[model samples]
Target: VEEAKRAGAKVVVVLATQREADEGRVGRQIADELGVGVVYLHGIQFSGGDEYCEYIKYTLAALVAALEASSGAAGGNGLWPLLILALSIAVVAEAGLLARGWWRGGGRA
Candidate 1:
């Protein structure tokens, strides 16, 4: 963990128990000692299968939240949504033109 930190890597610890996550004992110590983020499995077990899927979802969400909180990079500068809207409008217009041409017997023999 310390080596990773020294290498400029973001460290996050995932514990398997609620007490470690909520009580702020083991998790807190680890977080403070290594300056890392800590997330617990909460209601789900760490075993493989369906529980593993849930853990993956939870871990991804936690990671995204941590990144957003730390750097605000995920929020963007508000231009992406506008670009997406413009792309959607352009697609809709193209589709409309195709539909209109089809309706007017564009492929007539």
Candidate 2:
């Protein structure tokens, strides 16, 4: 888990059955221990398939809200500009890779 943090992964999700909810709570403990965040989906009975999907959707939405709130509070220069810069870099790199591949007779195979 610490290794994952070092590798730039911020969020952790723990999905557990109703009977295993207590054990799944350990994810929250681990997140607290690591001073990171955890989102847990518990009390999910495997028998109810569609309801489980709704529960998961709600949990994911809540997690996304928490992350966005945290990012807003810890704003350096805001995320939009940073995201744009990152996207631009990715586009340029991809284009360069395609160009190089085309030069090397690797085009549109």
Candidate 3:
């Protein structure tokens, strides 16, 4: 983190565990100490595996959008195509998972 500051990074994102969340509120403290913009995603204990996967996918999409926006002001068409592809893949994968679960007697529960 200190190295990042020295390297002139503008923002920081902290992904904290439950223990770290409790102990001194590490994420907020780090943000305050760094005096930079921070994004803290906390209270992750209640989330399930699928939720975590979805969260990761969403985060990746957001990062992709941000990177594409930062690259230039030409309004590049590249990102939209990539976004569409990613969404399609996610949708298909989710559908397949649902079908598999149903076939495995998941619907019984």
Write model 3 residue lDDT over 19-106, tens digit each, in one string.
3554436655665666654444444433654454476467657655544544454556466777777777777777777777788985
Return the top candidate by TM-score: 3
Question: Considering TM-score, where higher is better, how would the candidates rank from best to worst?
Answer: 3, 2, 1
> How many pairs of residues collide in each model?
0, 0, 0
Model 2 over residues 1-106: C-alpha lDDT tens digits? Answer: 6786686555556764522576567777766766666655554544555443345445545555455554546655365564555556656666676677788985
What are the per-model C-alpha RMSD values against the true structure? 12.3, 10.6, 6.1
Model 1 agreement with the true structure over 4-84: per-residue lDDT tens digits: 567754434455465544555765665677766655445554555544434545555665555445444555845456445
Off by over 4 Å in 2: 16-22, 42-59, 72-109
Q: What is the TM-score of each candidate against the true structure?
A: 0.39, 0.41, 0.47
Pitting candidate 1 against candidate 3, the one with the higher lDDT is 3
